[model samples]
Target: MKGFARRQRSVLGVADALRLGFLGLKARPGRSVLSALGISLGIAAAVAVLGISASSEADLLAQLGAAGNLLTVGAGQTMTGTPAPLPSTAAAMIRQIPPVQSVTATAYIDGASVRRTAEVPAIHTGGISVVAAEIGLPKTLDARLESGTFLTEATIHYPAVVLGAVAANVLGINAPGPGILVYVGHEYFTVVGILQPVTIAPEIDQSALIGFPMAESAFNPALQPTQVYLRSAADEVPAVSRVLPFTANPAHPETVRLKHPSDVLEARAKARTQFTGLFLGLGAVAVLVGSVGIANTMVIAVLERRREIGLRRALGARRSHVAAQFMIEAIVLSLIGGACGVLFGGVATLAYAAVTHQQTVVPAVAPLAGIAAALAAGSIAGIYPAYRAARLEPSEALRSGE
Candidate 1:
């Protein structure tokens, strides 16, 4: 009886508990698998949320990150209806601030993409300066020169255009056509050179980036550039919004201000904090549900294997031995289910990345933590049942069969 305690996990290493737990599972594989499925569902739900949540978080981060780095300042709110967008001059003003470095401004026409049918009615067509490159956006947006080079300040200030990848694909502008003419508002411009394709927001489809002055005159003559962007040294970016009048305040008291992208990133971080609690709540509910399965399986295993427990107890086994064995089985089931779920979650993440063409994010510690928690939950569920099994009297259990 004294030696029986030596065989249990309290004395036995983790490796022994695992081996015995797995052995129990192998002996009753069908029942083990059924029990595992319950936990699998719980893990799957948790992992699914994790995968999608991660993707959404990243997209939001990317946008917000863009805003922060490509530090834009402008009058955020417009008159209720008109929403007079931010003026480009705000960027110049922002640059005047001590911490600020270089700045570029663009006034977006956001012209309705002209099309014969409603399927593709509007695509973004706007103007930007070659100077816009310096203002925090060039690297992330990998627009390469395919047939022609990037627009010069001289070329960009005019109607010379660069097409986005999807835009180029949609507008049938991939190859340089001999007699290609593009019409925006019945106005026509010759296709100079086809710029390479890249990722941009969907709202700006069939879009072309032209020279600043050309875009302003063609799309918005009355308004100055609504979007003003600038670059500060990395360490200097923090002070930029505060230093500038247009961006210093939240309500935007000045003539021009736009929400800096960094604000969006901070908001995203707050959202992740909120979402983490939500996900944990969901996991807790799952753990609760999984506990029921663990309890049910352990109870049934105890009843069905009463003879085995009785024999083991009679063979110099201690009460602790039987209890430990039962608990180990439940824990093993949970851990195995968790491992499978992690693999499943990884696959799901890859699929999402493939379909969306976005980067695949793998949070290394989350899966392991998820599994450990499930095992803990299962152990807790098995406690009562294991206690009952350990307390069973062999003579009374034998007489019950009679």
Candidate 2:
């Protein structure tokens, strides 16, 4: 009974086990760092992928929320397969709807090409479209001017144009000024403004917007609107969209097509989620490889430390103590790697978000989950090595060490 009490009292405590575990790692610093690096790489990849994906989704959601109330009406094809035109009064008629907040329209000027200079060939239109826009177009579309000013009531009747973001780039015109002019249709139109990209209306990003009066006088006297854009009260968007086609063209509702611009953003968000899953699978593969590396390193550690294991066993240490020491070492190693990974991932996320002009958003679960995964990998990887170290016969180990 006394001997049994003494043996029980000699069992290793948690602190003692941890101390010995760290001591073992300290003895082989090179191997310890290399083993931890494997885990670090895997965890860093996982955390960074999740962080970046979350940031992208957050930015998309923000854009959707801001523009969700916007709806567009465009003329569709007629039964004869020819282009159908919307009535010039469509914007005014749609504004009469109770839920409609603002309305604007644009007329697509066919056969009208815009060029940087009149000397450039007419065939090199750079895929740009010339559109006749209302003075209220920028406000209705929620677009911003990168430089200069938008079309005003006083300037709409003159040969003035606002270059869309893409149009400005294609024309190699960075800013709008008094003398900056682009050849439109048969004449030179002074550039009045340069617009930033409009997320809800990509077509606006590739158009050279001229006012309706100038378009009518210079391009076509009987020009009809090709598209109408409107904003509705937040809660009334669905109802407004349902009645928009009928309201825009009472003669033929089917000839007017209605679209909610936010739907495209929602689809893109779904696609990003699917791609995130693929990236997570790749991260998992990396983790599995790291686990293998840890297991290999631990098995080698046990083999190389046979003499120490035997000395401890031949003294007062029990098999369970030996196992606990090895297990703790693995957990601690992976814990270190996880901490470093989290730090690296956070920095990477911030840098990427800043460069891409996206909002930074890291899910709280990402770092916690990464640490937990590392611990789990460590626990599993330590099992076989710990067991093998504990199972060594003291006598045999001592003989082999000699």
List where candidate 1 sits over 4 angstroms from the true fold: 1-21, 44-69, 75-99, 109-113, 116-150, 153-159, 163-181, 190-208, 213-223, 235-253, 350-361
Stretches of candidate 2 off by over 4 Å are 1-9
Give the alpha carbon lDDT tens digit for every residue of 1-402 in model 1: 775655543354567766877787798888777777767766766675677667767866775544555565554554553454554455555656776666655555554343323443344333311211222233433335466555565765654555545555656666544366565444555555555533322222345556666665666556465555566666776666566654433244454454555565676678786886797678668767877887898898888888887777667667887788888888888877777766777777778877876677756665876687677877887798889988998776555534
Query: Each model's C-alpha lDDT?
Result: 0.62, 0.90
TM-score of candidate 1 on Cα atoms, chains taken together? 0.70
User: Tens digits of per-residue lDDT for model 2 on 1-402?
Assistant: 665654453579888988988898899899888888888888888888899999998888888987889999999987788877898889999999999998999989999999998899999999999999998988888899999999999889999999999999999999889899999988998999999999989999999999999999998999999999999999999899889888899898888888889999999989988998888888778777777878888899999889889999989788999998898888888888878888888888899999999988889999999899899988988999999999998998888888
So what's the TM-score on candidate 2?
0.96
For each candidate in turn, give its C-alpha RMSD to the true structure in angstroms. 6.7, 1.9
Candidate achieving the largest TM-score: 2
